[model samples]
Target: MKRLLALTLALLPTLATAGQITLILSDKIETSDGKICLYENAVKSEQVKVTASAQCRHTMTFED
Candidate 1:
């Protein structure tokens, strides 16, 4: 429960930079390293909703 809260808190800041969100569920615990790819959704939403995956292009890498 605490981990979920922490993750939520961490992701909230990302929303400030953009409208939608990407809930990256990784195999490894650490989210601050390479081997991870970040992408923006091609189709955006008009109404309020949540999605799992998006038609994305290979965007920039995440840096620590």
Candidate 2:
């Protein structure tokens, strides 16, 4: 049982992922000015949520 537990623990990382996060989806909205709004220069370690992953840009927009 102990060996089995150790094996599971050791193989856990292989089963999952490491370093950086997996971006599931993103949001891309068009501005009224006919410009495409994009997400970029996100703060350090920030996560953005979007309804449609395909439309998202996998980035974050910060207010200057």
Candidate topping lDDT? 2
Model 1: pairs clashing at backbone N, Cα or C within 3 Å: none
lDDT value, candidate 1, whole model: 0.40
User: Candidates' lDDT values, in order?
Assistant: 0.40, 0.47
lDDT of 1 by residue, 1-64 (tens): 9999999999987866664344333222223332333333453222222233432233332222
Off by over 4 Å in 1: 19-64
Residue 43 lDDT in candidate 1: 39
- The backbone clash count of each candidate, in order, is 0, 3
> With candidate 1 superimposed using the best TM-score fit, by how many Å does residue 24's alpha carbon deviate from the native?
29
Query: Which digits, one per residue and each the tens of the lDDT, describe model 2 over residues 14-55?
Result: 666544443322334545433343443333333444443234
Per-residue error for 6 in candidate 2, Å, reads 0.2
Q: What TM-scores do the predictions have? A: 0.28, 0.27
